[model samples]
Target chain A: MASNDLLKGMLKPIILKLLLENGKMYGYEITQLVKEISGGEIELTFGALYPILHKLEVEGIVKTESEVINNRNRIYYSITQKGNSKAKEKIAEFEEMVKTLKVFFKPNFGLKYEFIG
Target chain B: MNSLDSKHIRLIEADVENARITINNLSQELVDHICCEVENLMSSGKSFEEAYTIIKEQAGIKVLQQIQENTLYLIDKKYKTMKSTMKITGNVSLALIAIGTALKIFHYPGASIALLLGFVTLCFVFFPAAIYLNYTYKKDQKKPMLNLSILIGGIAFMIGVLFKLMHWPGASLLLFVGWSIILGIFLPILLFFKLKEAETGKERSIYVLGVIGLITFEVSTMFKVFHWPGAGPLMILGGVLLIAVFLPLFASMKFKKGTFTMPQFIFLITTSMYAVVLTFLLAMNVSDVVMDRFVRDEANSTKIANYFKNKKTVAANDSTIKVSTELAERTDNIAKLIFDTKIYLITNVEGVSESVAMKYVSDPDLINNKSNYDIINHLLEGENNAGLINSLKKELNEFKDKAISVSTDPALTKSIQELLNTSDKQMGIGGATWEELNFRNTMIISAMAQLSEIEKNVRLVATIVK
Candidate 1:
């Protein structure tokens, strides 16, 4: 399981990427998909997730539309044009950060891996 | 897999309400989220109550509230910026007003600029910012309409009051709108809601009576500011309701509910404040010393006005217009100067018009030893009247200098010198006993006699000059 502190910084980019692919999603569906895809390893608390979603909405990266579904008012969030462009930029940044983390964490055995290859 | 029915969904919604989600949109979103989570759990073969318990235990009440808190934080960033700006500007403006008022009192520099900056910031920046912040906060709390009305009315009333206090423009319209909205709409709606929200008849009566007291107090102040009638009665009634009825009722309610600990302290503090205000009002209304001054001031003003009116009449009569020669003209001018000086005394001492002043001077009963002797004596003798006397002395000195240069007549010069001497003698009336009120009246009478003599001599000098 990923630590919450570690997951906190990556949650926005991850959600943006999910929206980029899924086209549209409500809060419960997004939470369920994240749990499913991560195989229950990365559980996002609604407490932590809602704020990030709201911040994105405030930044105009996402827009919401409410509909009554099964006698319930469900609000669905979709990526805007601004959100699409921002998602691409954020995904690229996240990939680069991951690469940097990989280099720092990989066991070197006292030699650079590229030189060994 | 089993799914919860509509009644079970309502239970979930009630739980969300219990979580204290005040924002309407946020509450709806939260309800939907919780419903989906619980339904998913129920579909996995747990019963409705079992699924609900599992979901609630996993989320925890604190975390459920945190979601709402985070949303609020995100939205509040925009509001917080304005709120801080309003607070800063309000504080700065208040400081400037305080400094400016102090400087103005002491006759120092930078007073006007400071006052203008303070007033402008308070009226424009701080007040608008406050209105915006108040509007946004209230909007989220399910009373957007009431909030907007209060914000507009409160801001308008405050700005109008500021303008009226500073004697600026556009106070009338602002005041009219502000009073109408606040008194007519906002307060009634607020009281209606307050009464509606109360669970019991006791609570309802308490809210209604409390609001009546507060409204009566506000109306009393409004009446006083506009100089309308019923200020006194309204004030007394408000004070009685607040101190006698509202405070005790409020305290008793709190006691019944076991919510009396911290609230008891608040009640005591509020009661103390009300007591202080009531005492001050009583002192202002009932103190004989204060009322005596007011009555004396009014009477003196009327007498001064009468005195000046009679003088105008006497002067307009054809018999008194005999400035036919240069010497007589000079004498007439001198007499006019003496009368002008006397006018200064009457106006400054009695604060009355010319006709009223003539009546005061002629009415022997008014300046007699037994009646109003203390007042007349104090006006002539006390430090209160010294400012007028000092200014009079300066005017007389300037006249002397100019008359000496213009007139070669020793008689006119001597008359001017004698008038100056009588002014000095009047100044010496300070330490005299209250029993010497008769002596004080005699001094004023003799001064008038000297003035008449000066006028007669000026007429006699007309033949000499011709």
Candidate 2:
């Protein structure tokens, strides 16, 4: 599991990307999907996820729909057209960041290959 | 795949409720998430209770609350900041008002500064923030715009009242605009919507009656601020509606439903409300009684009128009143100056028309008469007259021993100077409102007494030509 501070910065793009791909998802479903996809490496806490999702909703990047399932109301959030473009831009920027950071960890570095990006 | 049973889902719902997740959407989301996590754990061969416990332990209750807090913060940073700022300013304004009232009561200085700061902060910071937050928060709820306007009108009306109390410029305009919005738009819409949502016709009518009372009261207050007609009648009508009509309706409702857990609680509330209404009535009566008695006992009105008439008669007898020198000429202007000062006190401070106030002096023709003891008598009965007296004293100090050495009585001038000094201490600390009435009355009386004493030692210092 990633530390909360590190995960906090990463969660926004991760959520936008998830909604972009999944069409629509509720709070728990998104957390479960992340756990499954990351093979338990990135366990998204409800504490961390909901706020970003809510912020996204407030920004008009995502909109919610309430549906009754198993006699319980589930609020599902879907990415808007704005969110789709935003997600793409964020992913590209993150990749660029990673590529630049990767250059600093060239062979013959102090750290082992296992910890390298 | 494992899914929670109805019983387990119900338990999750109860847990969300226990967490005080009052926001419907957020609470629903929490329950779903908790159920999903419990089910996933249960699929791993744990019992239902064990699975729930394990998931609960993993995601602490504190974490659940943190999510709610973070969501609130994230949705609007300005809302959070404004909310806190509003609270701070609201408290500060209230404190300042309390302290200001106390200062005025004790006849201390800085009362106006405190009051001005309080009102300005309330109007600029607190009201704006409250209006913004109420609008944004209620946007998702019913009648968001109406709620916004209601808050704006209510707050604007309160600000106008403060402005009036401070006797600030544009008080009339502000009050007019505020009352128009509240009475013409907000009140009607509020009544219509509240009645529309009424559970029973009786309840509907009761609330309507209450609303009518409130509207009448507000209208009367607005009228009172502007010094318009029918203010007293309208105010009484509003008071009757609230106390006689609304209170009884409320009691009947409470009794019919048996909603009161403690009988004494309802009784106490009703009694307290009655006390408040009675207090208002008593206060108004007391103010009138005090003002009448004070003015009559002092007889400043009669004295001032007599003095004005005597001056007029004396001036008529001698077309060109002779004085010894230039100093005597300057000294002669003092009487007219005091008369002008009296006129200013009557028109501005008392908020009475110049013509009407002139009637208070028995002689209409003496309105432009030269100053005398009677003129000072009436002039000193005003709160702002203290300021005029102080300025006059200052001007006298500049003239002391320079051009008029023999004409003025030293002992009388010194006493007048002392009185003016004491009056200056009471300056800007009292106003004409019910709350400040006692302080203001005392200040005016003290100044009047001093002016009367000064009037006794009449000195027309005729300068001896070299």
Candidate 3:
């Protein structure tokens, strides 16, 4: 519900960026940080976040460590040494794409429809 | 910040369990995440119940299960391809079958081709892909034998349907196995699962009602396909249960709860479309089966008459041959005219060419045209109409005279006269002419059989004279 599926594709890099900056964060903390940083424009539902986190874990881009808090276990995700570089690469790649996409937003509109090629 | 105690943690865990989060890592993450969310909300003066309700809205069971499905799908490339294949072939077959059925009802050409392509796509591509994807889904969920019976039953049923449409052998075996597995094994397993999963009394009743209705409808489909008795009562019962009892109750409940989702919408359309098309294609009613028997009778008479012709050729003397020559030619003329009429009926009715019509009627069991009496009547009947049947009738009366003159024996001459009679006298209560009595109410296939029978009798009378 956070991004209405538009920000959904960008979540993987966002999570990796958050993990790189925080060094170590639990699931709830990551979500709250995202909401706060995006000025409540983004809400990371645990449903979407955990799958990406688990996939990152499986891919060795991030790793998990568990601690028993209250009656259940809290899993903390942190970027690995390899993930540190991968996170920067993914974030830069996304930033470059977005910067280039801005060109389309200000394009001369409907100028070509008259040609009828 | 207030933290959750053991009791609050158990409550969160119970809700997570209700989502069927079977994966250990995913389950742990969800319970802990909800607990953290609830605690943070509690710190802001919200009660535990209020916070939990807010969390459940975002992470409902449907969302949680979808995450698990997506994660599993992401991990396997082959599964993704098969899943896409399942979707593509299913839709393609649906499109082809819809087009095919429309064409068939309108008596257009290419109906058989479209239907064949549709059935082939369904039986070979979609069913296999669907089974593989379902198996992969069950494996990922760690639910053993979850969709086994339904998958097997569906594949068998679809393949059996394909075979039956093409009039291929071994369809009965496949249909029997398919129906047995669905009715005997899958329905019972489904019933047990529904009972175990449904929580409330209303939910249980609805589930049981749905299963009973589906089973009864499927049973009637089975009975109708196999031409067994009791299909009518069962069909009516199933229709009442589904339409009167089940749909009203079920749809009302869903409307009240506002729980209808996109998948349910697709499922409703696809399932009903499939049932309608299957019942229409698979019924193989009484008239069609009787038509096959007439085709067989025509074939038998032709074979016997050919045997007599071969014998007559070997045994004939010069004088006898000369005497019966006119009779033979007239018989051959009428026979050729009748064969042309049969082909004309098929080509016009099916919108196919002469060559294609030949191919269609060459296989007796596979003939589907020649059933429309109204169009045939329009084509072949009227007072003083110069249709092929009238010309053939005129040719027959002349041939009857030829047969009577050519024969040496008086008894044989009388029998040939009776056999070749096309008189206008009323044979029954009807005030109809000889043409109307024979071809008006009768199917084209039955008429064709009678024409061939006349040809056979002509050949026999000629052979006896020789």
All DockQ scores: 0.42, 0.56, 0.53
Regions of model 1 farther than 4 Å from truth: A1-9, A17-48, A58-88, A101-117, B1-24, B32-88, B97-112, B132-137, B140-156, B163-181, B192-206, B226-233, B239-466
Clashes of each: 20, 3, 0
- Candidate 1 lDDT for residue A60: 91
Off by over 4 Å in 2: A1-67, A70-72, A76-117, B1-24, B27-71, B139-148, B151-156, B226-233, B247-283, B286-466
Give the interface RMSD of candidate 3.
Answer: 1.4
Q: Which residue pairs of candidate 2 clash?
A: B304-B374, B335-B371, B407-B461
Clashes counted in candidate 3 amount to 0
Which structure is stronger by lDDT: 2 or 3? Answer: 3
Chain B TM-score by candidate, in order shown = 0.51, 0.50, 0.60
Candidate 3, residue B357: how far the Cα is off, in Å: 8.8
Predicted candidate 1 versus true structure: per-residue lDDT over B72-104, tens digit per residue: 777668765786788899999999999977765
Assign candidate 3 its CAPRI class: medium
Report the Cα lDDT for residue B383, model 3. 54
Cα DockQ of the candidate 2 complex: 0.56
* Chain A superposition TM-score per model: 0.89, 0.83, 0.84
Q: Which stretches of candidate 3 lie over 4 Å from their true place?
A: A1-10, A41-48, A81-85, A88-117, B1-24, B31-57, B99-114, B138-146, B198-209, B247-365, B369-466
